[model samples]
Target: MDYIQPFNRILLVGCNECVTVCSAGGRKEVGLLSSALQSAFLSAGKSIDIKEHTLERQCDPEYVEELVGMMDGVDAVVSMACGCGVQEVARRYKNKPVFPAVNTKFMGASERQGVWAERCQGCGNCLLGITGGICPIARCSKQLMNGPCGGSTNGKCEISKEVDCAWQLIWDRLKMLGQEERYLDIIPAKDWRTAGGGGPRKIVREDLAG
Candidate 1:
């Protein structure tokens, strides 16, 4: 079956927690997107049966239990949660098809209200000492460990005026902190082996595993 089609009866599910905090997908977003999709289908003379619901968290098995009876009549589920939440829902309902409504961005701390910026790449190595604490891998366009490259001009990245060169920011911060000497230190090339085999990666905590 073409499960994600507008012609089929579908459930638009949203997470009330993580996605809400991230301002990506939430109860309000669920309603907005569902209405928009329905309106679009109606405008095109195509009928769609869509129902909306918001769970405390789609990634939890307890929360997903609520969907047991609900799935019987739906053709598909459009999850408005992070990638992990979507996978959790799919794992619980193996018979049903689950589709993601939003793209998963990154693992970073929220910088401000309605703003989440990348701060770490989980590189398994900390080199903030030599880089003045600013992460060139995450903030720089080139993800250069030893950077500012030859193209940086007036503290701005050569790629775009909107982006300040990460190395420039690092240098400025280090200067303010009276740690400019750290900027002169060389950072060796990153070890990609720790990042896994350039494919799917898995972490097994023996202590936590049964």
Candidate 2:
């Protein structure tokens, strides 16, 4: 991500809303990134100035507008928000370059207190009705739409013992819900063309637009 721009006065901006809820891009993360960048620059004897700021919500235009005046002295900004927030910042400040500090993982729920696992692939077509509500695309290592490969043993995936096979979870869930017959149906291969295309994607809802 750093290869996108050459920054001198870098502003590490974080968000206090969704990013904070996901425990990724928050005030603490901003401070940590600022300190780390400062240390790296100092060690290389490079005179780069870095600052930190946390917005209530980076995606909101009102909150992002406040950054316009503050960006006067900065050369570039490293936003710690999701891809949506990064694009929002870039859209607001078209003259300046904005880089993403954190990798946008996915839209999913947290498995444990601090462990968030991805459950959706945003394939544009959802097949949870037949898969017992478990997403094989995100959970399975191979993203197999069908049952677990011969690699699953003792409920763990062949790729790693620590990871649970998605099919295993689906089977268990179906049995618990008394809907094991759902797995009998076969699902076809997902079309990658509808997902991410060769370039950027866009969605326009004429009715939703004012």
Candidate 3:
């Protein structure tokens, strides 16, 4: 917070992608945060100017380029996007001081209105095909691949009765799909490299590369 005080003008940028869907770093969230910051500054007897903008996707350079014109009088940038978008912004504008306003949580899906649940880990090797579409890596307390641990009881996770055991869900789904036999198959130790165990990972499409 002290680092931001030096800047007289801050640009609050938002993403209209995942953050918008989850109601975290969307345009609405940008406005709320901007107002809150302004109030805090005014209360402290300091004046600060904040400009708000929402990009279709802050992670894409084409969308981030829109900020070029908006950056004219901005002293710093505060991104209301996930970590990826923040890094993209930083990469595009190395001269500007860029900061993330929201913490990036796990890759997840909206379970219901106002409820988002972790669904994927972006492990590179997707196991949903064999796990009956349930991802144990993200949902399971221990991220067990082969089956449920002893902590699972009555289809509920040991962490909480409210949390459904991912393995149980996988088994039930596999049973319904007539693929219960797949559960008996042993999943080998995962290759750690694809899951970012090796430095930063990337996908380069030769056809799309310039």
Candidate 4:
């Protein structure tokens, strides 16, 4: 509310992707936010116009271009999506201000009902094939690649008792698959080039973009 309080005419955009599945930034969420904003403004004795729209995907220019017509009618955009969607909206609307309603969280998987756990750092290179499908970078507190650190106790990470040791899971999985020898083989340090150490990443598919 504080970020967008200045804008009288707001464009509330929602994404129907990861955020929707997580129940943070979907059509229903958009509606809820819109209602909340309306109620707040009404209580303040001020009226605001908020137009709601949910795109199939917000990161792509094709989906974002749908707003080209609507942009002229709105004052600013409040994107209920990951940072990527907010950035894309900002990129498309250079004249209008774009605000993010959701804090961008790490790439993760749903642990259970309303629970999500970080699962990938997107290092550009995946090592899941050797680690028994478990990501050490995301699961390990220290991001140890070779094996479990000295603090691993009873298959629990040193960071917390509830968290399972990633390397311990890997070793157990390798043993189950009769590939215990793989754990003995040490993994080398990760090259940070693919992990966005150099700069921002881009993927252009000539087959589609062309």
Colliding residue pairs in candidate 4:
none
Stretches of candidate 1 off by over 4 Å are 1-3, 108-117, 196-198
Candidate 3's residue-wise lDDT over 1-210, tens digit each?
Answer: 576799999999999998998999999999999999999999999999999999999989999999999887999999999999999999998999998899887888888999888888888888889999999888999988899999999999999999999999999999999998999999998887888898899999999999
For candidate 1, write residues 1-210 as lDDT tens digits.
234663378988999987988877899999898999888777877888999999999888999889888999897899999998899999999988899997988877787787787877766677776777888877888888765888789999999897779989998998899987777777888887666545666689999989
Q: In candidate 2, which residue ranges exceed 4 Å CA deviation?
A: 1-8, 43-48, 60-62, 197-199
lDDT value, candidate 3, whole model: 0.92
lDDT by residue for model 2 (1-210), tens? 254236788888999987888878999988887887777777877767887899999998999997877799998889999988899999999988889998997888888899887888777777787788888988999999879999999999999998999999999999999988888877887887667753566779999967
Kindly indicate the candidate among 1 and 2 with the higher TM-score: 1
Candidate 1 lDDT trough over 10 residues, lowest sum: 1-10
How large is the C-alpha RMSD of every model relative to the true structure?
A: 2.8, 2.8, 1.2, 1.3
TM-score of every candidate: 0.84, 0.83, 0.95, 0.95
lDDT of each: 0.84, 0.85, 0.92, 0.93
Using lDDT, give the best candidate's number. Answer: 4
Candidate 4, residue 86: Cα displacement in angstroms equals: 0.8
lDDT of 1 at 31: 89
User: Which model scores highest in TM-score?
Assistant: 3
Supply the TM-score for candidate 1: 0.84
lDDT of 3 at 73: 92
Candidate 3: clashing pairs of residues? none
